[model samples]
Structure formats: C-alpha cells, structure tokens
Target chain A: MKNQWIHIFSGTVKVKLTGKGIERFLNQLTKNGVSIWNVRKHGSEAVTFYVNLQDVKKLRIPARDSNCKIRFLERAGGPFFLSKLWTNSGFFIGACLFLGLIMLLSNMVWGIEIRGANPATEHHIRKELDKMGISVGKMQFSIDNVESVQRELTDKIGALTWIGVELKGTTYHFQVVEKSEPKKAEVIGPRHLIAKRKAAIVKIFVEKGEPVVKVNDYVLPGQLLVSGLYGNEDDMKTVAASGEILGETWYSTKVELPLKSTFQVFNGSEKRKYSLKIAGRTLPVWGFGDPDFKEYETEVNDHPIKFFKWELPLMVEKKTLREREEVTRIYSREEAVESAKELARKDIKNHLPENAIIKGEKILHQSIENDKVKLTTHFTIIEDIAVGQPISQGD
Target chain B: MAKKWGQYVRKWMTQKMDLPQDVMMDLPRITMIGQVHIYIENHRGLLAFSDGEVRLMIKHGQLLVKGKAFVIKTILPEEILLEGKIDQVIYIND
Candidate 1:
C-alpha cells in the first residue's frame, strides 16, 4: 500500500501459490526484494498475493526453491491500457484524418458576394477574381489578401469609382461604387462672347450671334468677338451667343536638359522568401538567409489564415526581392537641344485645353552650361479663346 | 538462569535510561486498532497464515493471533499488517 501508486503505473500482477511451506515461499519473495501486499490464504497450502509486475521474474527462483506451483491471475495498469489502444490504431488514424479534412474545408473560399454593382460589372469582377485564383472552392491561403484584391480590382476596372473588399468566414464580400457621369448645367441667358486672352483669330463660326470680329484680326482681352444682338436696331432681339472661336496663341518657355542621365531599373532576377507571421513576429518557413543582391526591391504580401468564421492571428507572408541595375544615357549636343525644345512644347501643351493644337516650334536661344543644354523656345498653338459674359442692363 | 539474569539486567538498564521496553528487551511491537486491524513490527518472520489465525516468530517466542476472515494486508521483512475480526492474541514460548 505504501508504493501502490508506483506499482499501478509500472503495472501490477496477482499471483497464487500452492505449496507445503507457503510462509517460507513468501519470506523468500521478500528476501529477493519483491514487495507483495494484500495476502489472502485460500486453504492450508494455497495463498494469493499482489506483486509488482516487474518482480514476476524474480518469483520463479523462489517458487522453485520452495517446491511450490505458482500461477499469475491477472495483470492490470498503464502498460495494459497502452497496449489496448495500440490494437485499435486504425480507428485513431481515422479520427485524425477527419479532423484534418474539417480544417481544410473551413479554410476554403466557399462563396463570393458582390453588392452595389450592376449585373455586367458583377460578371466582369467574377471573371477577374477567377483569373486571380479567388473563385469559389479555392483555398484561401493561395489567394492574395483583401487589401491587394481591392487594389487590383480598382486598377483593372475602369467603371468602378471605389470598391470595398471584406473577408467574412468562407465568403468574400465586395461593395462597389460605379463611376457615373455628372450632369451638365447650361447657361441660356442673353450673353456676349468675348476674348479671354490676347490672340489673333484663326477661324470663327457664329451661331445665334452677330460676328463682331473678322479672321486674322488681333484682339485684346474683354474685346467682343460675338454679339448677342441681331437685326436692325429698331427690331433688335437679344439671345445667347454660342459659337466656337479658334485663336492662334504664342508661348515662350525656358528648359534645361541634362546631357547624361543615370537611373535604376529592374534586371528581372528575383528571389522569393516565404515566412509565417505569428503574434506580430516573423518566422522564416521556406527560404533561408538574406539575398546577396546589393540593390533590390522588396515586396511583401500577407495572407491571413481563417478558422471557420473567425480570422486567425497568424499570417503567411511572402517577400519578393527583385534585383535592379543602374542605366546611363548620354545625349549629344544637337540631341540635347532638340529634346529641350520638345520638353518645352510638351509643357505648353499641358497648360492648354484638350482641343489645342501645336502649330509650330522654334528655338530662339541656346546655350550649354555644366553638361546641360538650356534653351528658350517659342511655341504656336491654336485654341478656343471665347468666354461667355452675361449681358448687363446698362450694356 | 543466565537468560533470566540477562533479562533482569536489561530491565534495570531500561528503567535507569528511560528507554522503551520493546527496544531494550528485543521484543516485537504490536499495535491494535479496536478489533478490525493489527500492525506488528520488529518480527523475525511469518510462521503461518490463514483466514482464522496469523502466527509470527518473535525474538524469544511465537506470537499468534486468532481472528475471523483474517487478511495479511501487508508483509515486509520486519513488519506485518493484519485485517480481520480479532478474537484472541497469545504468545507460545519454545
């Protein structure tokens, strides 16, 4: 009873002995360091007792010396229990496989819901998602995170003004905002079209107005180009002046172009490393060691894991390191001057309206300073110069 | 006569040194809890055991216990625990 707990863990055996000198047999067992407890006598020559499972071997010599017949009644305890479990190993493996299948199913993308989008846009978005491997039944780990999905969708679709992506449980939800055209407000009051800038008239077509200025006539700002009053002064009627006036404008710009330029570009050699982020810490999973490239661009993408409807805190992060190299371009003197004039022309074009056309370009002055070509250039452009002015009572 | 004198001397020493009699006289220590259990220590060996009686060899004599449904709860080199309904306890000199 003193070490009964230890005996249960190591195992215990009940043994029965039948002999002439049973007491001598018990004493011999004690002398051999085999502890026995709960001794009960069946008759004058038969006795039963519990002994440590390990001491069953030591009992043979004692039983032989005492000329007794020994029999093991039962064995019980931890070893027997483990052996019983081993006999049913197939059932244990089946339970484990079932649990793994449930986990895999829970992490799959089961459904996709797109809201606030038309049927056409929804179909287009679903196609894009399929191409990106985010369709139904796809494993969530193999797809990009929600933020990247939102960015990619917005970039690919021209009609979407804004889109929101949310991952809930095994489904992906998309909230879309389509880009709609704004309504225009027209000005129909009696007005006059005046020159908003100083320019020579190139072409003019008056509609519902009287022509006040002719082609090739130079006019100043606020000068009338089209008048809303028509007919004789006795029967004059007022109406809105609406017409297109093409004007030729001049622009002078100063630009400097470097003779030599150096920039970095990707060399197409990339290394990918995958790691797991747990509790805000990164643990490298696949790739080991730092990349050897000195100049490289790093791009990290995180895909959070999900367990049923709950988002797990752990994430799989993929880091891509792309090697880049510096490139240098040297321009000749003539080439630099030409590029400077082109740069000035592009600058003026950006400032003008969409319908403006560049008529001519000329380099008025050119100089070289510190390996850069500087020039002053004049550009000729044709654009609309008329702006509506509401008729005042005094006018 | 010599054994009797030895016992007398040991008893006088026990009284003078305030020593327990069981230790000084080399006698088995027997403890009983009502009539259900008995614990014996400082015994030489188990002489015999049965459901009705238990016998142990002490230093100078054989200690016997008569009980109904007797069970040897524990047995070691120097100790024995007995569980049953005790009827009598006696000692037999060789």
Candidate 2:
C-alpha cells in the first residue's frame, strides 16, 4: 500500500542555499506541474518555502558537494481535513441518504387519530374514510378528489357534521364532529303514553291527565296507560293530543347466588403487556405471550382493528394479569335472610327508572325453592314511563 | 595543530560561559506588580531600570523582585513596573 501522507506542521520550508538555487528549484517544480504555496526567510542564511505534495514529489537536487541542504518539514493540515470532508462523493452520498429518509417517512402516516365521535358514529365514519382511500397501507397518491369525497361522505352519513383533514410531519390526522340526531316532537294529536315492554302495573299516579289502565292491570308493549280525552259523560272531545303517564311496572326475576361463592380479589401484583396492530395483524412490542397469574382467572378481549369515521386502522391492545385470592365464608340464617331481601330489592329496582320512588315493599314469601333460596317481594313504586312528548299547537 | 587547539579552546569557552546567541528568540517572561500582570514574548534582558528594583537573567529569562507592597496599576503586553520599597531581588539562567 502507498504511504498515506498528511501535513502536520505549518511553518515555511527552509533551504540553506543561495537565492539563485532556490529560483532554479521553483522553475523545475513548475515545469513538472508542481504548485508552490508560500515562501519566507527567517534570517540571511535560511529561506523556507512551502509547496504542494505533487510538486514535492518532483523536486530534485544537484550533487551533495554543492552548498545546499534539503529537508522536508511537516505541515499542519487542519483546513485540509475540513476540505476533504466536503468531497464530491461524500457530499452526494449524504444528500441521497437524507432525501431517502424524508421520502420513506412521508410515505408512512405516523399519526392517524379521530375525535368527537361515539362508538356507532365513529364506526360509520371509519368505513367512510376507508372508502375515501385514507385507511392504513393505502398510499397518499390514491386519494384524488379529497374535497368532494369529504362532502359526499358527510352528506350520506347522518352522524358526521364536520370533517377536517390535516397532515403533520409524516402523519395524517382526521378530525371529525358528529351531527346530533334531532329529538322527536311530542304527538299532540290524540295520542297516549304506551307501555314499551310487557309488565304488570303496580301503582299509578295521575299528574296531568286521566288514567286509562288502572293498577294491577297486565299491560303489553304499546298498550296505552293515559287517555288524551276530555268532556263529561256525553261526547269525548280530544282537548290535548297526549297526556303524561306515571305508573310503576313490575317484573319477576330469578337470580341464583351460590351459598358458597368463589370471588377473586386482585393482589395488586399485575403484569402489563403492549401490542401494535396493523391491518388486522397484531405485533407484540413489550411483553411476550399472555401472562399466567397464580390463583387468578384471565379474561382477554383483543381488538386489533379500529375505525376512525369510516376508515379502519391499526390499534394497540393492552392486557394485564393480576394475582388474586378467593375466600369463602359461611352465612348464618339471619345473614342469609337479609342477603335474600337485598337481592330481591335490587331485582325490583332494576325494573324501575333511576328517579322512581319506592312507596312500599312487602315480602310475600321466603322459602328454599330447589336448592336455592327464593324471596318474593311486592313493591309499590311510582315511575314515569312516558317517553313521547305531547305536541302542542305551535309545535 | 594550533588551529585545532584554538577550535577546542573556543568550544570550551562557549560551554563554560553559556552565552545565548539570539537574545530576542522565543523566551517566556512574566511580570506582575499588585493587580496588573504583563507577559513579554521573546524577552531578552533588562536594558534599564527605574522607580523599582529589576532582576533579570539573559540566559533563562527568569526574574523575581520583592518589595514593600507595590500595586500594579496598569499592564500592557510588553512592559511592567513596580512601585514600593525594594526588599529582595533574584535572577537565574535560562
């Protein structure tokens, strides 16, 4: 291998020779395509000159008998080092790498997020977005008519009120606002508050109109509870189109709670896992397989695909396993009775609205029915089951 | 034979005396008095002295002077002065 030459000193090259001899060397070097850099004299006896490496190679001297000495001094090459770094090949390769990185990053959408949507509205929006070529793995070039596509999607889907598309860095973010459904106006032209499901009426209160069905009446779905009629014994005139109905409905419920139940309580020590999904395929990024917890049950619900407006994209799923301890204790006769009463009250409460008033509760019977304790409860409640609004003249 | 003897005598005298040829060559010299300090590059020796005592060595360019509380008022790159009672002085060869 040829020796790699580097200049490590900066002072002038000194030659203890006559000025005529120095000029001769310069002429010879120039004839051979050598370059001279600088020349300086320290005193009368020595003259130093700097030359390029090519010129240095072409330098020759006469016989040693002549009164002249030739010595090669090192030169510092700090600026040369900087110049070499800016070479054509190095600069070209650097530019290519940078441009390649930018191109690759622009092709992949780093962020895709949807906001202001309920689950159902978001699902429809996601489907619409996918049809508009905004889904994962779809190139940006495929989307030709962006504005018209957005307009068509919003007009067809009743949920989306406004949609916006934004590109930040390499990611495309879709922001959406769902249109709220208009509420139904009250039926003012001869209507009644009807039952929505099959239930026996337990109590009734007439707040604004006459009741059609009395208490203890078994009503089916769509059966009217309050009549929208007025006038004495003669011809019944429909004064108001609809009347408000407030009645308590009853339901029979059978819930089996084992005498010795096993319930797991988490012991605070849990393991968390993370995954990344793309196009229905999930890739685990953090934890390995599903975790195994001691004395614990695992419930895994993995949803690898997510929709934004109408576009389906990849989603990350997280699962956690926690250690648990199951403990069981025996219940005395009074404890069991109280437990049964509580369970019956919960069952009756589930049948009524959140604002229902429980007027009274009476235990009809308590017995062991086929290896399970059963308690029959008779509850008097006042609740409003009227969902339709009464329409007036102006409305 | 006499010329050879004279050359040997000249070399012995130079070695014994140790006189430097270039007095203004790169020599490190520092001077300080009170709050000001000065450094003279390529210093040779003291040509003259006034207002304070001067101690210098032409060979080693080392000089130190002690006095009764002198303050360095101002400083430049080449020259320095001291203002106090001259108590001690020393010099060494380069």
Candidate 3:
C-alpha cells in the first residue's frame, strides 16, 4: 500500500539507456542517491529502468559522463493523464452535447393518453383538451395552469363530470369520468285510487278525489276507494286522484326452531405464518410446517414498506390461523319458544312495507315435537293501502 | 593469518554486541511468499532483468532468479520486493 503511494506521488517515469556505458551510468545514479528500480538489460547494451520524475533530470551529467544515450519510454500519473485529456477537447464536448440532447428530449411531452373513458368520450375530451393547447410535442413546463385548462374543457363539453391531469415521464395522462343525465319521469293521464289489500277500513282522507267507500267498511282488493271523476254523469269532469286510506291489517308467520344447536366456536389457539410479498408474489421465508389445528380461519395482516411518498412493491404479510371447534348445546323448552317467536317476528318484519307500523304483536300458537318447536305469530299493522288504478278509455 | 584473525574477532564482536547474524555478516536475508513474491534484504545493485531471469548483487555472490514475467514491486536502500512467477533462486559463488 505504501509503495503504491510512493510511486503515484513521485510520478515515476520509464527510461531506456543504450550503449556500452549503461552500467556505469546506473552505478553513478545509484551512488548519487537517486533510487531506480526494475532494470531490464537487453544484450548488455540497452537497459530500461523506472525512476522518479525528479531524478530523471538529475541523470544528465551521469549519462554524459558514461557516454550512454538516454530515451524516455513512458510518463505515468494522474497529472499526465489529465494533461492528455485536456489536449483532446472533442470527446468532452460530444459527451456534454449528448447529455443535453437527452435532457431536452425527455422533458418534452411525447404521448397523450386518456384513461377510464369510452373511445367516443375519449375523442371528445381529446378534442377539448387540444383546443385548450394541451397536446403532444409541447414542452412540459408550458402548461403552468393545469386547472384552468381542465375548467375550459369542462365548460366546452358537458360529457366530463370529473377530470384529472397528470404528467408521467414523457407522457401526458388524463383521467376522466363521463357525465350521466337523470332520467325523466312518466305521467299517467288520470287514475282512481282502489283497495290494494283485503282489510277492514280504519280511516280515509280525501285529498284530491271523491270518497267511494266509507270508513269501517271491509273492502276486497280491486274495489274503488276513491273516484277520479266528479259531478253528474251529464256534466262529468275528469281529475287525477290523490287520497290516503289507512287499513288495520293482520300478518301471520310460521317458524320452526331446533332444541339443539351446533355452532363453531373459536378455540383461541392460533398459529402465525410469515411471507415476503414482492410485486404480488409471496415467498415464504420461514415456518414451512403445517399448523397444528383441525379447523381454522386464516386472517392476513400486511405491512407494506414505504419510502418517502410512494409505497414500495415489497411487503411483509403475516397470516394468523385461528382454530375453531364445533360445539353443540341443548336448549330449554322456553328458550326454544323464545327463539321461534323471534324468528317469526323477523320474517314478518321483512315482509312489511316502509309505511306500515306494527301496532300489536303476539304468539298465537306454539307446539313442540321431535326436539323442535313450531309456532305461529300474529302482527297487527296500520298502513296506507290505497293503490292507483287508471280508468278505461271508455271514460 | 591476519585476515583469519580478523574474521574470528569480528564473530566475537557480533556475539558480544548481540547483533543480528544477517546484519553483522552483511548477508542477504531472502524471504519468499509462495512463488509470486520475494523480498531480499541487504542487496547492493541490479545486474540483469529479463522475461525469465533476474540477477542482483549480494555481499558474497551474485543472486540469480529464474521466473516468468518478473517485475520489481519496489526497491529501497536495504530491501527489494520482486513479484511474479518465481521458479528457482540460485547464488553464484563468483
């Protein structure tokens, strides 16, 4: 290590001396305290030696006194290499020009892409964007106001609901969401309100139609509850019906619940497995053996390694397997009855409309057989049962 | 007779002064590392260097080194380090 530094700092040079007096010349240099090494002799006349740059100039008198001809072979060191590089300027200029060209080319927008849009919609947006001076081959820094261009596109075309502009590498990526217009409502000319369900009438209110059925009347389905036309038959006027008729209704639901139930309960024993996920591919590093469990559920938790503002493609995933066991428990008669009624209530609740309110609830009948309970529950509901029925063309 | 007596007195002086044998006798202490490196202490000057041979002047004789592609690593006043494939080394009594 020390020898290399000595050679470099001293800046050694190779010299070749030829003639009958080369030995005397070397011996004289040696005696003069000039260190030279690695001497190779050729035919007792020519000799080559490496000496420091400082000592090469001091060899003049010795070479002259010994009558030996001297010639320099090579000069080596950092300074010599730098001097040679400085003499040739064409390579450095070409390299700098190449780098500048690459920088300029990479900063210009080359391709424009529209994502998440249909072709026709994409064409429309592209046209709108082009009119706003956002297009390919433009310099990236020219678009100083991206939101203004987006607003211009929105004002020119009604098809874009939301839009985002992003510049990635040399491509200009545009994200777009198309607009959807609300549908128009249809109007049926004139109609009458009739009984939609078989129930005893609780109350009736005429908002914009004449009442055809009175309160407390048990009406069958399809019967007219309100008339769309008013006045006499000779001077009859047609009108749209609008009214509300509340009916006291009854609903029955049948349920069967078993006295013994089997359930899967987690046993609190868990095993964890680790894996390294790279680009959506998982490679297991340890724990290759299978988990000791009969029935289990796997829950995966992952922690992704992120750098700065970007989430890297690598992650560590831990999978935990929770062991489970099937546990059966016998239910009492009263518990079975309670469960059956709850089941019936839930079933009836699903069938009722939004406006129907449960005024009364009770279990009417319940019977147990073969380790099971069968029950029927009744619910009293009050709701607006008036439905629209259009009049015939004869009217 | 005087020269033989001088040699005896020099040996007795070396032992009395507790000096190293190579330094007292001015002999070349040659060391080698495998066949790739060789170091010679107490060398005087270079005699010849070729592709397959190297010769140097020691105190008592000329040291000949047979090798392939020999190159001198470094040289100081007291020691010279040589590197390459060294096959054999011999001392010429001349």
Q: What does the interface RMSD come to for each candidate?
A: 1.4, 21.2, 3.7
Inter-residue clash pairs, candidate 3: none
lDDT head-to-head 1 vs 2, winner: 1
Tell me model 2's lDDT, rounded to 2 decimals. 0.55
TM-score of each: 0.72, 0.35, 0.47
Model with the higher DockQ, candidate 2 or 3: 3
DockQ of each: 0.64, 0.01, 0.15
Q: How well is candidate 3 docked (DockQ)?
A: 0.15
Candidate RMSDs in order = 5.4, 24.8, 16.9
Please provide, for model 1 over A1-395, each residue's C-alpha lDDT reduced to its tens digit, 9 standing for 90 to 100: 38567778888888988888999888877777788998999978899999988888999887777778999998888797678789987899999998678778888999999999989999999999999999999988788889999999999998899999998888899999987735577758999999998899999988879889999999899999999888897987888998999999888888989999999999998898999999899999988887888899998988777666666788889999999899998999988887887789788877999999989888899999999998998888898999998887576
Ranking by DockQ: 1, 3, 2
Superposed by TM-score, candidate 3 places the C-alpha of residue A337 at a distance from the truth, in angstroms, of 68
Q: Which of candidates 1 and 3 reaches a greater DockQ?
A: 1
Error of 1 at A33 (Å): 1.2
Candidate 2's error at A249, in angstroms? Answer: 5.1
Per-residue lDDT for A108-226 in model 3, tens only? 66888888788888888888767666778875544534566667767777888887876566677788877763557767567899988888888999887789988899988998999
Which ranges in model 3 have alpha carbons more than 4 Å from their true place? A5-10, A87-89, A113-135, A142-160, A164-168, A175-395, B1-9, B32-38, B47-73, B82-94
Q: In model 1, which regions exceed 4 Å deviation?
A: A1-3, A14-25, A37-50, A63-78, A116-124, A180-255, A277-283, A334-366, A375-395, B1-25, B29-40, B45-57, B60-74, B80-94
lDDT values for all models: 0.89, 0.55, 0.79
The top-ranked prediction according to TM-score is 1
